[model samples]
Target: MSPTMTEQIVLTAREARDVPHGEKGKFYERASERLGISTATLRRGIRSAAPSKERRRRSDSGRYALSREEALLISATILHAQTRDGKRIKTLKDAVRMLREKGAILAARIDKDTGEILGDLSDGAIARAMRGYHAHPDQILAPDPVTELRSNHPNHVWQVDASVCRLWYLEDGLQAIKRDAHYKNKPKNLERADRFKVTRYVVTDHYSGWVYARYVRGAESGENLCAVLIDAMQNRGDRDILRGVPEILMMDKGSANTAGMTKNLCQALDIRVFPHEKGNPRANGQVENGNNLVETTFESDLRFYTVRDLSHLNKLARMWRIRFNAERLHSRHGRTRSMAWLDIRQEELTNAPSAAACRNLATSTTVKRIVSSVLRVRLGGREYDVSQVPGVLVKGPLDVAYDAWGDEHIKVVRTGKDGRPVHYMAPLAKRGAGGFFEGAALIGEEYKRKKDTPAQTARAEIEEMITGERTKRGAEKARKEKRLPFGGTIDPFRGMSEKDARPYQVPTGRDHPAIAPTVESPRLTPTRLAMLLRDRLGRDWPEDGYQRIVARYPDGAPEESIPEVMAAVTGKKATPDLRVVKA
Candidate 1:
């Protein structure tokens, strides 16, 4: 048992005075330790006439102490103490390793941002210093060297991740919204309702802090995560604006990120994907901080009944995205994502071209084809209509080909009669695969499929035979065959089965008229005859309506200044009705 501190202090004071003058203070400390009185208390008690109020106060002050030489020995002890291998520091001695080092020690605090020392004190109470306090021989702590590595350009690097939403559903019999409102002294109906448990992937521009959130089924699979990421990048007009891919992709080493498919996809895209170190999630502090806010901000209201229905949950996540990017202020930027994104690149935005720069891009006109009034279209908008087929089912995969301006043309390729290439309008619904094809630029298979088919080969052969009819041989044969089949004793039809009942007739040579009959000819309008004359005379097409002019000369007409020809043709004026109308 420890003795009364007052008794111990008086004994130490008495011993100090009795000892030789050279050893007075040392002797007093030794005697105080033997008597269980603190050296500080002994010194103060001896300073006054009686060991009273002042003695008690001083004793309390010197509960933890060591002399100058003793401090150096303790510092050496701290420097060499064997710490428990994996255990974290909990006490002052454990923190500074005071049990192993014996040297003069001082208390210190280092800056969080810059590692420089904020304060230091050389004291004999080194082993008894507070937990956060540190002892160093130098005047201050060292500065961190990594602050100079910040990025300088916009879109230089973007951090992407999937995280849970921060919205919650509380199922208290008294509706959560109403309960909150009631507690706040407002009407129950005044509180806003919320949904919970939707998983979303958040992307943040490292430099600008611009964020985009997309609700996904889950981030458990590499395919789902990759699909969401690709969609977001394309939608933001990244390919149009940057014209290149990101240099680095930072992610954690989850199964989704480290899977073989993910590795192959990243390699194909030429992106360097890096994983954070194990046990140090703070390595991705920017994204981790965003996640912390997501989880912590709505912790009180979150309630997950079951993981079945994610529709309402997904809707709430989408709403939070608008709030997070458009309304919430970031500590680093001191502004919302919209404001910061513009402010960061204001120079480039101001200097870029206006209307004249956009002339190089192409545009398209859209047309519609109505069938059964149902109006089913596979395409996105009501545009692009100049070449639409009304009632034919198009075959093959739909392709979305874009010009420089992002104008889309839905096209399909088919073989022609000559076994050559032909292009046709592709069905709209089949064109883009709902924008999934755009990601193909960044992450699709590398090979293009060949378009030849067996049907095309058969058609090619038939067309070749039709074109190569021998002129000499076929003409002579046709002349010989023109003779009456019964007189010439030749069969009237060729390649007919003997059992057929129908008989064919061959034309009688020399009996056929030298010129074809004219009475049976389809009647040609005066306008048609005049058009033929104008074309034969090398005149441009007339702009006037021919139907109106034909009303005056319905039968025939003579060319102006061709009077002799008109008389030879039995006409009064050029028009057939000139006699009746003129009279």
Candidate 2:
């Protein structure tokens, strides 16, 4: 008959407390198994509910007391067996044997009658217990090698990796903050703490040569790898530049890349994974080259103490990547990364959904504010009012962009300029009823200056003012240097053929050197000298300078060494009348 619940509880407590002291440690496991409960639950319930003091049992002895390590080992054995393979090691005798195989020591009873181990313990028991814990051949999961992945545009396959760097944290000015009651800066002398372990993960576009890099504590962890990828995707200037989530990510079999949890996350996001052969890890050559380039830039030029913190190193990595892609020229692409990207992606970019639709929902965005309202925004310790117009605002960050035109002004907050987002009021005087085109010029300027200044209205106004001044100066110069109206008659040089353009004959020492009358006083100017020489020796005039000018009269021969020398020698001040030549 099955024991009642109360009776089972009583028996479990009795085993834990009244079992001979020499056997008390072993009783919990045996009693828990027999009573159909966990050792932990049984121990807890008995310790709390059972009578603490008991009459000394005759079998009580010190030899069987369970040490802490032994208890932990037994508990670990039970837990390990509780997994899918748990049921196979069901009996206490089996559990003890498994524990011994896992480096535990124990004794067992045997039956003299059938030569079988009694209560499930016997010779080779440890080996038998290990058999149940052994993993099946089919249980191992292997990585699948993907041979190919095709992409039509940028961001298709962003490769990531890590490297070490030494960084120096500036402290001189950082010290002032500690003294200032209002200052809340972190404690200084940070660079003195040497030896930072830096890891850099870079994502390079297969097509555009554009790359993004981040300094992480280590790229070996799934968390940091995921972070760098997300950072690259989110910070890109053009989000829709990607055709879709990358079709495949080519990576080596690094711990971070092949982590089960990370792999699962990638699957959930529909990112296919392709790992390179174990020994041959160069499948992602682009990003590896990117790391080298980063090293060249930082290791060669920028000196640092050590890349101690991941986030700080990442910030520096971002700055370096921006410079590498936007400003630095690459020999392979024969242009800047930005230029190459624009060359291949311009058409696709034009066709992408409007920037308004592409703004990420996650980040605090720039918003446009009118001049009538002063926006209260602070960044990096400075304060500014946003221009009242259509600007970008990162929701609650108090950052604002002013766009008096259609394209928002907040877009210009990228690096290279004042990286912080700008906030300025639109000038009321300039507000006019010009359609989107009227605003388009400002919009274009803002787009061009996105990586320049963060202040929306200030940048716009400065561009407009500078442009107006240049235009006015140009118009005044044009008006002052007047040109004659077109003449009704066309008689001479129109449609002249090459045959009509005879060689400019000039006097040589071999031909007419004696009769070629030299001018009493040479005209210093090229035009005057050429004419005087041509008239004196009509068929023997030097043709060098005159011939070049005559070929393209208005455009004129370039005022180079030949003309300058002729003018210097001739004493005449007249400019070169590049139109005339003697043949």
Candidate 3:
């Protein structure tokens, strides 16, 4: 035991004066007793009153032993060895063992009594080092220096996620649980759970902190998530103006964040997706904070509302979302969500995709599949005919970008002579395996499907002779007989003529197939200018390079026309053929 503060103070005074305190034995002993110390302790305390040297910590000494570089490597390995939920799958011992296996000799401490050595890289030491280094992520693993997340502008980025509601509601099956106290009810039936728990899917603008939420009765499912996202993409709420698709979306590694959904959503909306680091909620802090608000601001007052079903819960949630957007002030801008959203210029908010488009994208799935010899490709345990995307399902299996689940439209990524994406024939869904083949593109009169004439009947006979025979024998037999590339669809032409067939078109000149839509400019469109540029710059010039040249003249798109694209493409020697512009 150490001496009391009073004893230490008095002892210090005595030591400074060189007083003979121990000489008065009874007096010192009584003083020591009063101070909760012995006479010997009192004398030692006085002698130690003069400040002694400070003892250093073990970490300070060993800090230099493990170089910062090596410590970071070990720490990074441990960090990355975590699961999606952020649980460490690899232990410190495992990390050390791996380092040793890779010929990295680490420091160790020896047991004084047993003469055994233990590696110095303990879990606690690594954890402490990590905490120190997290303050400076620049020295460690980080996103590319050029790529950084921005949250100052609307549509810059948006974060989405789902969380379990903190409060429970009166579910249908179990009235007994709801009758008890908030903490009371515990049910043991399959139809019921601990009172009730609901999932809340939230979407928030990273810049404005505007939020949209949906409450569901069941677990966090992908279908429900898709529905909520579709709603957010299509509808503008009563008070909130946060409607358009974000330029980039941030999310965690939840099942709903699958590649199928991401690719379709991103492609359809022309947006980008940045999945949050595994188990790192801070990366998606905007929406995560919003989720907490869903619990605190709304769910906290659950007792006030007479909640009936998931619909009622969602109704209440929408009103809460409206209030959160219109009434609540944002910390960053000191403006309400609606104000921040409205502050953005109208031109910045482009066209919002229609509800039909949302449905199509939500159902679309992009899969890398090989087109079979029978002009068919297998996917999701079913084979689909590729007759419409490429008329007659030509031989090779190129990149197929299609959404078959809904409209079942397919677009074969076929390149042109300049090796650029060309709009090929838009093929309809083929029949078989619960499928159907529609018509092809209707860009021009030439693109229109040739009505079945005497020639087509003979051609169909020849097609059946080659495909039907081999298809019956199977794909292997079809492979042997390459005469008919693929078996024709059951209704070959979907049994429809130009008189009443559905309208589908690919807009491009026969000589130069356009990759994307023509720009709105009357004088110069990207597709139109690229054609002229390509003519001047040899046949081998890249299509994108020409497009870039057209884009460089900023006046053309959404502004005055600039013929700089032609001037830049055709050098001084070449004469400018000011071809008349047409849409």
Candidate 4:
């Protein structure tokens, strides 16, 4: 079989590569002439067909000669000089120069024989070293690996985020959509619109991608956040199908989202609040994408329509959200968001409380009240009869919550037999015209007696079992005859004191060996005495004179006897005079 063009080129290139270096041009010319092509084209083809040899590498390849500490120092210096936005203001050369000048880094090379620095350190070397050591600014500032998250069912996890609607603003009770031609680079227009900037709060179900949005005037605040959340959780008719408290709410760690009121509301509804780490917006990327979706699909059309105010904008947002969720097909599920949400089981979906009740839960704390002897508890300036609540006891503490659906009643929470919380609707106690409780018997027209409570019945049974009588008179007679409670069968201190009890032995302490005191010799050295004499006489004394005085004294003279010692040594009355000298 005849060789193909590629194979022929490969054979020619192999022959040319093995030829003598000086005759390479002649070899290429001969090959090109035989192949009936130009020398340049043939040479190119030969070059392309030849497999390149692997380049040689040094033993220390991919390793930095610079120590890790030096590389880290260079990186830190550059990073420290960067701006708040992470723009590097200091170049590698600049960093190297500064560090070299400060004696923070040494020359790149040294002579092994002479022990002298022989090579100058360059910025390129430092940069290469940083890259090799993984201490470069780029490597240090790179984003961390993202963790993929998932949801088990609809409403299992929801993400909420707020963004300013920079394209539109409320002015003169109407929406003013900004145009790039007029407001793109105009600072004055932006400044004016900043006063009426619209903030959009968006929430998305992680599982189904269903979205809910609300627009409000001004910046994000705790009140606005809570209001948006409450509205999103309420059933807004059949058009808007996404409504319920999510099992877990994911949001940015903004002040409004982490506010006490926001946490309290979520807690009241049994929703867990999860705030993403700072500088990690992708942790709640679902809601962020939802924000962009609304901006592009819904708000883009607002310029063609008229919006009266914030309320009108929110109404439009609601309508758009409903249509978007119902019509738009989700890329992941291959179905509309509404349909995907409908796949949730009945038990997995939790119905939200009324708007008024949710608002109360957000703003108010659960009030604790004690039930009165009459089986009534006062809450919100009204008295409610809790006698109908199971396990209700007089003077017992009860948690009271506002009943937004029924103003005439309040909800009471108590522990049930199963150890879970039980809720009850307690009606307002009826009051008579004279401010007295109604249901009392009239003088002659009616006769009525209050029903005995569980506590009252238990008390009567206990009295009958203990005293062998149910009547008050019989109980009193039995108590007098018994003298002591429980028929004198109970002992208050049965095991406290007994005949076998012995007195506790006092612990005796052993005396420790006495330590002799250390006595220090009072004899002063010649140098010390010389210094003291110099200070006392206001003049320096000879070294020999101080030595002679110390020798004569044998035992060191006390500090107070310095004057006498000086007089005895000098053979004259020496009156020591001292004076302070100011510098």
Candidate 5:
């Protein structure tokens, strides 16, 4: 039989290994020719078929002399020495030396048998042990995992954020907050300029990346927040496409954002307010990035251009924002923000109310007032005639909201039969001379009265049943004569009085049976009883043993009777007076 190629290769490799080191190449060349293969192939085959060299390992390989606690202490020391910016000032060796000086770690390991000291501790060894135990600075300081968010549509989610523009302030005009000898970033300079500092409010649509920015003088407040939000929501102009109310408004948990005024505005607009957790600005990163963009792209031009006042700055900002949204291509959608937002369907976009109405909604709180006898309600120091509003009754409490569009009228909110709010615009009542309503009939010329509400009719029926009169005058006369509302024909305490007056025969002492003494037993949980049984039996306890015990004593076993019960279940003799101790 002829030798196989593998066997020839193996024989060649054996011969090559025995050849002198310098002549192995020549030997491989000769073998390649004989084997009808290239020299490189023959060498590779020889290398593969030859036995691999054994690398010796030390006795203490893969072992660390430093304990996990010592490594952790060293890592903690190094971490503690880091600056606020996370720059490490101390190295591992420095940490080990410091720890040794403080006696937190030993300088060397001592042998337990001979008390002989080993070599000085190695920083490299400590570092390796730290990496092995996951106590290194990189491992401990790793960032938490982040979750990416998605938006369904342009107006589905909007992020609003406020940031202080540290560059400029609006005093007489736009002035730079220069960091010079006179106006450094000291407490005095910052405190004096705090009121005049420009706060930039930015709103970004999460899906389209369209940004709306407005510059406000002074610090952030609920009024400023509402003003910016209103401007962003309302129609800007024909050219600007970012308008309408968003379904969800996401912001930080700032006091101004979560204030009652902001909440009321969002509620009135039917927008859900979502405040992200504290210290997590990434939740609203879109707006945060919008702020940065505004600062870099728009505000960066302020150095060359002139900004007369906050209004002027806001005007320029709006213009730049519109152009940017209409021109710049968004990286995510690969189109201009305006074009992306234009994809919104008419039904998906909710048209916002007028600026005045939105402002009123944000600033004013809903109030409750009862309609007067003349079918009027007072709101915002103005009396409105609600007589024309359906379901409104005299002296009935109605939910009234301010009408920002006109001071001559107010909105009356009422719950309809379907449990939804029905709004009515109630016009302000005109008062005639002598404090009478203008629409009222003259004293002698005419006579007119409002129709009675359902409550009034019910009251009239009650009066007729009680005082035997349907007219208000007659009902008043009956009331003056001391007539009760229910006609004074019923007694409320008759049954109680009859029962108190009735006599009952008392039971004789002999008729009562003797009372038996009842013994109270402490309740034991299934696990507790199982544990006790296991400890007493000193053997493996099955789950069925607990089931049997529960079935026998559903209420609980008395502590004193535990021994007898255990003995009976285990088929062993009961111990004398053995009681289970309360744990």
Candidate 6:
């Protein structure tokens, strides 16, 4: 029996290894001709091949076809041909041609027995295999590895995530209410706050792409997250058809999500918390996908609406949501998100938490703080004076329970193991008013502000003027009396003239010229001279002394010494070039 081409190459290389160094090249050349293989192939197999390769018979199959090992080598070579940093690397096509060099056999061959092609791997095939290996992990090791998630109904699982929005909103609305602390009057502070983008808390239905959202000023707190959740669950109208307490609140391990208070609140409401591992948000891909929708579609629509404040942003977002859930079609079902949600809602038994169940429940949020020497504790944005509590010894940090929604004032106290209220954590009185009964009113105002028409806004301004302002005369007095950003009045009159003291007012008529005393006349004597001063002193005088002007005037009756008194003590001036003397 005769050895096949691959067998002959193996045998030749084995024998060539024993040949003298000077005769190795000539032997390889002779072997290439006899075996119908390239000298380079013979040289490579000789250098890199193992000594124990199996032989093939002339009558056996795979006579002209490349082996699995050969195929892999060719694929690697093709992959190496890809460009590196714009430098010319070998091309895959050129690399493949090297396999078919002159006198070299191709990987595939037509069998003479059945006229069938065996092990037919093309250059294109090799290139594809190579690129796939380098580009993806496990493509070669374990191909098509995926675990598809199955959500049978809406709210079966809700994925929640927070992403900073891409664009800044106009700060004019947020700036309407000034913040004394945090970004106070800093240069570009408002711009920076807006440019940095507000955080958007998104809740997405896993079964449907239905989404709910809230945009806030800073990082999400535990209470804020719960509050946002409440909004998502509360069904405002038929348009808000996606409302329901999710069976599972899937989220990342953010401080807001992981806080004990947040867990307690959800547990009380019978909502399961499914937090992903610290770094993996893809676990809750529903919300992540929602983020993409926001970036592409919602944000694109925002170009038309003004983002002045949270209310405005939320209003626009709500309208966009309606369109997104009802009008826009989903790729998976060829139906809208709202349609999908309604379809699932038909069969699913939803257990949405009631308003009564959630009210005042956010008070579980607790923090520890040490009382300063001033007998006060600072919580949220307000300070409480414990000084009135009288004769309390110095103490370290105290556990304080506060309103998570900021809808109530904080009470300094310790909580039981179950997070129930215990005794007073610290002896202190509630210092100031917080988000209480009027919180709803404030929210309504914000909503109105956002949706206000030109007429409504003007009317609101007029009402504000009526309520926050005084009578014209009183307003004048109030404007002159300087106060603070918060309260209390003092004479801020130091740096201002009388006109400047009343900045909001514009002068008219005689008041247009300042009420300051002029050189022609100073203060009225308050005696009988008051009539004389009030009646005749305003006339403009000449550049010379007042005596020249007074002398040219007619004298009063002999009974009245007022004219002589005025001539003796006062000046009447009618001067264009005259200047007022300082009083």
* lDDT at residue 282 of model 5 (Cα atoms): 84
Please identify which of the two predictions, 4 or 5, would achieve the higher TM-score against the true structure: 4
Clashes of each: 32, 43, 10, 0, 0, 6
Tens digit of lDDT per residue, candidate 1, span 506-557?
7776765578755543444566555553443343334442543365466755
User: In angstroms, how far off is 274's CA in candidate 6?
Assistant: 1.1
Q: Each model's TM-score?
A: 0.32, 0.29, 0.45, 0.59, 0.53, 0.38
lDDT of model number 1: 0.46
Pick the lDDT winner: 5
User: How far is each candidate from the true structure, as Cα RMSD in Å?
Assistant: 33.8, 34.2, 32.9, 26.4, 29.2, 27.5
Q: Which tens-of-lDDT digit does each residue in 67-175 have in candidate 4?
A: 7898899899999999999899998888878888999987376666897877875678777888888999999999989889999999999999999986878887656
Overall local distance difference test of candidate 2: 0.49
Mark the 10 consecutive residues where model 2 has the least summed lDDT.
Answer: 169-178
Which residue pairs does candidate 4 place in steric collision? none
The runs of at least 3 residues in candidate 6 whose Cα sits more than 4 Å from the true structure, single-residue gaps closed, are 1-144, 173-191, 194-196, 344-347, 351-359, 365-583
Go through the candidates in order and give each one's C-alpha lDDT. 0.46, 0.49, 0.62, 0.81, 0.83, 0.60
Candidate 6's residue-wise lDDT over 375-414, tens digit each? 5577765665443332332354666555323324455554
- Candidate 3 — what's its lDDT? 0.62
Q: Backbone clash tally for model 3?
A: 10
Relative to the true structure, candidate 6 reaches a TM of 0.38
Task: Report lDDT (Cα) of residue 93, candidate 4.
Answer: 84
Q: Highest TM-score: which candidate?
A: 4
lDDT of 3 by residue, 1-583 (tens): 3346755656544544543656556656766786776778776765566454466767655343344666667766777887877577787667767986886645355555896865565656655555565622234446444443566577678888988655564576212234444443333543454336677889998777888888776776667676777777665654656777677778887777764665565655656667777857678877888888887888777766567777777778877888778998988789998788776666666556676677677677444666555456665455565544533333455565554233355545555677634433234435443343344343465365443334446665665565665233454466576644545435456756788867789787566575787666455556655665565567645646665664575434322433455555443333445454444
Model 5: clashing residue pairs? Answer: none
Model 5, 324-411: lDDT tens digits are 9999999998999999999889888887888888977887777899989889988767788988888778778888876545578787
